[model samples]
Target: MSLFARLAFLMLCTVIPAFALASVAVAGSECPAVDANDTQARNSLMYYVCYHQSSPGEPAHTALNPAELPEHIKWTPSQGHELVFSQTRSVYWIRLNIRNNGSERRLWYLNLHYPLLDEVTFWRGDQPEDVLVTGDQHRFGSRLVDYRYFLLPITLNSGETRSITIRIHSSGALNIPLKLETPEEVIAESNHLAVTHGLFYGAILVLAIFNLLLFFSSGTTYYFYNALYMVAMGLFLFAMGGFANQYFWPENPKFANTSIPLTLALCALAMTFFGRSFLEVAAHTRADKTLKAILWICAGFTGLTLAIPYSQAILINTALGLVIIFILSIIAISRWQQGYQPAKWYVLAWAIMAVGALVYAAAAFGYLADFLARESLMQVAIGGQVILLNYAMVQRWRLLNDKLLEVEQKARNDLEYKVHERTAQLRSTMRELENANRKLATLSLNDSLTGLYNRRHMDNILPDLCAEARRTGRPLTIALLDADHFKAVNDTWGHGFGDTWLQLIADILTRHATRPRDTAVRFGGEEFALLLPSTDLEGAQKVCEAVLEEIRTTSVEAPGGAKARLTMSAGIATLLPNENQQEFFERADSALYEAKAQGRNQTVIADT
Candidate 1:
C-alpha cells in the first residue's frame, strides 16, 4: 500500500470507535434500534429510552436523555420504599416501553400515586390477573404476598411482550397516570421540593391576608395599594409553580398559565397607585402622572394579550412591562434621595417588589432556567416584596400620625395664644375702669374743703339709706347746720378768712360725728349736713344741741391775724318710712327755717 492510503486507514480506525461511543452516549442502551422499514413505529415514539447497570456503587436503575426534563419532573429527597412519577398535561396517552435485558429475576410491584384516577393491570401470556400487583407488604403478611414475582415471572417466558393498560379519568389528579419504577431515589427529592413549595405559598398567603386586614383597618391608600400588591405577588408565586399549587391545590394546573400575566398587571397597577399616594407624587411633580399613564398603557396591553389567547405574546409583553416598572422604581429612588422624605419608603418598597417581579418575569420568559428540586425563586421574591411593602406602610402610618399630632399641637398653641391675648385685653379694660372709678369718687363725692363727704355723696346714698331704714324699722335722722353771719365775716377778714372759717366748721362736724355710720357733708357755702343711721328725733336734737354750743364758743383765727367768733344753727329731722327724698328734705328745711327764725345760736327739731 502507498503511505497516504495507510494514513487514511489509520485515521478511519481511530474515528469509527469515537463515533460509536458518541452515539451510545447520546442514545441510551435500552433505545430500540431504528430500521428503514419501521418508519411509522419510529415516528410514533415520544421519548428515547436509556439504561444504566444496577450495582453497589450505582443506584438500582437510572435513565439518561439529552432533552431537558420539565420543571415538574425534578426529584426531591425523602425516605420511602415505593416511587411514583406524577404529572398533568393536556396531551392524552403516555406510552412506556421498558426493555429488561438483565439475566437475574427481578421482583417488582407497581402502585398508582393517585389510584382513583385509573386502574392499571399487566397481561401475562394468555391469562391476565383481575387485581394488579401493588406493593402493600406492610399491610399484607410476608408469606401471603398477592402477586410476588421475579424479574422473569413464570407466566412470561423470554422474549414475550407484557403490556399494562392505564385508563385515565378526565379531572384532577385522575387526569393523568403516575409512571415510575419502584424504590427510586428521585421520588424522595421530588417530595422535598413539593414540601418547600407548599411552605413558600403559605407564607405568601399569610402576607396577603395580613395586608388585606390592615387595609380595612386603616383605610389608608397605602395599605390598600399594598394589599392589592401583595395579593398579586402571591398569585404570581402560585402561577410560577411555587408553594401554592404544591400544597394547596397541587392537582389543578389551570391556574399555572393564567396567573402570571394577570398578577403582573395587577401588581403594576397597585404600585402605580401606591406611588401616587405614598410619595404624594401628584402633589410634587408631573412625572408621576406620566408614570401612571404608562402603567395604564401596560395594563391595556396585558388585557389585550389575555383576550387574544396567545401565550408567547403575553409572556413577551409581561417581560417588557416589568422592565419598565423596574426603571420607574429606579427613578423613584433617585427622587427620594433628592430630599423627598415620603418618597423614601415608597422607593424602597417598590425596589423590593421590582426585584421580585424581575425574577418571576425571568422565569416566565425563559430568560433563566431553574432546577425542579430548588425552591421557587418567584415565591421567595414575593415574600420579600411583602415584607418591604409592609415596612413602608408602617413608616407611612407613623409619618401620618406624627403630622396629625403636629397639626393638632399647632392648633392648640394658636388657640392658647388667642386666649392669652384676649385675657390681657380684658385685664387692661378692667384697670382703666378702676382708674375712672377712683377719679369719679374724688370729684363727685369728696368734699374739697375738708376731704369729707359732700352733698353729692348725700344725694347718692340718702335714698338707699331711707329704704333700708323702712325695711329694717330703724330710726334715720339728719342734722342741717349753717355758719352764722358768714357774709359779715367775709367783708371784715376777706374771703380767705371766710373760707378758713367754713373749713373749720366742716372739720368740726366730721370729727364730732357720734358713730361710724354718721356722715357729714359740706352742703354748700357756709352750710353742712350730718346723716345718722339708727338715730331718732330725740337723739338727733341732743347731738345737734351739743354741736351748736361747740361751734358758738369756738374761736377761728383770721388769715390777717385777727381772731373771730363762729356760731352755727342746726335743724334736726327723723326719716319717715316710705317717704320720697323731696318730702324728707322739705321737713329738714322747715326745721332749719324755724331755727333761724327763733335765734342764730339754737337747735330745733321738725314735727313728724
Candidate 2:
C-alpha cells in the first residue's frame, strides 16, 4: 500500500471513535483483582466502574443496550466516590466487571447505596436470562435482595469474568454509589444498621411515652401535642432512611412516593399544634396566625402531591419546610426572651433540624458531596432534636415533682399516690383484656387448623358481598374446592399425615386469594372456599386452576419418608342477576359436586 493510503486509513480509525462512542467494556483485564483472603468488606467498586449517559426518556434506555452501545462512548473512573450527576432528565448507565480468579465458586453482595433513583435495572451480561429490574418506582418486594437499598447477589465460577450493566433514570440528581462485599460483610453491616435503627426508634418511643404520661398527670394538652410531634418526626426520619420500605409498606410503591409529602405535611401540622398550644396562640393571635396560615398552605401543597407530579410536590414541600423552620425559629427565640423555659430547648432543636434539612437538601440537589447525604445523617439530627425536646419536658416534670414535695400534706399525698397506683393497675388490666379480646376475635373468624377464614366468616361476608355485586353490577365469582382421595390417604399414612396434606392445600388457596377483598375460607375438613370479588367467571376459574396447579406441583411429605402429590378439585360460579346469597352459594357448591363426579383434581365451571 502507498504511504498516503496508510495515513488516510489511520486518520479514519481515530475519527470514527469520537462520533460512534463505546464505553470501555468490562473484560478480564478490566475486572480488578481483589485479595479474597483479606476478608474485608468496603467500598471496593470504584476502580471497576465506568459510566455513560444517554438522553432523556425511555428511548435512551432502549437505545443504549449493552450490544447497541455507541462505539465512541467515553468512560471515566469513579475515583473512590459515586458518579454524581446534576438534576436533569437523563438516563445513566453504569458498568462494572468482576472476575472470580479463585479455584472454587464465589458469591459477592452488590449494593447500590442510593435509594431514591426512580428506576434501576441490573443486567448480568453472561447470564442472558437472569436480568434483575428494581427501583423505588417498583414495589420494595420486587427487589432481588430484600434490603432497603438496591442490593443484588453476584456469583461467579472459577476463572469466570462477568460484566454488570446498570441503567438508572431519575429527575432527581443521581449518585452511583456501588459496593461489593462478602456475605459476612453484608450481614455485619445489616446487623449494625438494624441495631442502630432500633436504638433510634426506641428513643423516640420513650420520649412519646414520657410526654404522654406528663399530659395525663398535668391535664395539659401541651404535652399531648408534643407527644404527637415526636411521633410524626420519628415517622419522617424512618421514611427518609428507607426504613418504612424495609418494614411498613413494602408492596405500595405509589404510597412510598407520597410518603415524603405526607410526612412533611403531618410533621408540619404537629409542629404547628405543639407550638400553638405552648405559646397559647389564642393569646398571641397575631404572631401565631401567620404560622397557622403557613401550616395550612403546607397541608394544601401536600394534598396537591396526590394529583401533581412528585418533583413539584417535593419543591413545594421544601419551600414550605424552610419557611416554617424560619418562622418557628423566630417565635422560639422570642418566647425564650420572654422567659418561657421550654422555648430555649425548642429553639436549639429547631436550629439542628434546619441544619440537617439544609445539608440533606443540598446533597439531594447535588450541591453537597454525595457521601454527606446518607439518611443516617438526617436521622442523627432528628434523634438529637427529639432528645433535646424531651430533656425540656423532663425539666418540667422535675419542677412538678418538686412543687408536690413542697406541699407536704400527708393525707393528700397518700390519696394521690393510691390513685396513681390504682390507675396503673387499671391500665395494665385493660391492656391484657384488650390483647385477649383481639386473640379471641381472630380465633372466632379463623379456622383452627388451616389458619384460613372459617365457614362462619364466609357466611357473614357473603350477603354483603352479593348486595355489593348487585349494586355495582360487577361480577363476583366464588369457588368451592376440596382435596381429592382423602379417606385413602388417611388410611394409608394416618390422620397426622392427612392433616399435613390438608395444610398444603390451604397454602395454595391462600396464595391465590391475596387481595384485601378476596377471601379464602376453610369451609370444612379438607374443604376450602374462595370468594373473588370483582372477578368474572373466567378470572375465578383462572385463580382456581392456579391454586390447583400449585398443589399438583407440590409434594406432601408424609410420615416415614413417604411423599405424595397433593391435588384439589375446584368449581367456580359467577353471581347471576337477582341471585340471592343462598343461590350463589348453592350454585358454587353444585359446581363443586359436579367437579367431583366428573373427575378429581380438576376444575369445573357452573353452567350459566
What tens digits encode model 2's per-residue C-alpha lDDT throughout 1-608? 22332233233222221122234444321434443323441455565577766775544456635666665555555545567664667788777777777789888877887777778888876465667778878888888888877887888888877777788887556766787888888899889988988988898889889889978876778789888888887887677667787688988877777786678777777887777776545454667777778768767766876886665565556556666777888988887887777778888988888777766765664445553344668778887887787776676556555644443231222235544555545333443544543475477878878888898878877887888899999989999999888888899988988888877777777788887678889988888899988989888888888998888898866778877876779888999998888888888888889989988889989887
- Per-residue lDDT for 132-183 in model 1, tens only? 3321111111212222111112222233334332222222111121223333
What C-alpha lDDT, on a 0 to 100 scale, does residue 138 get in candidate 2? Answer: 88
TM-score of each: 0.40, 0.58
Error of 1 at 566 (Å): 78
Residue 551 displacement in candidate 1 (angstroms): 81
Q: C-alpha displacement of 207 in model 1, angstroms?
A: 2.5
Candidate 2's TM-score? 0.58
Colliding residue pairs in candidate 2: 20-71, 20-72, 21-70, 21-71, 21-72, 21-73, 22-70, 22-71, 22-72, 22-73
Per-model lDDT? 0.53, 0.73
Best TM-score goes to which candidate?
2
Estimate the lDDT of model 1. Answer: 0.53
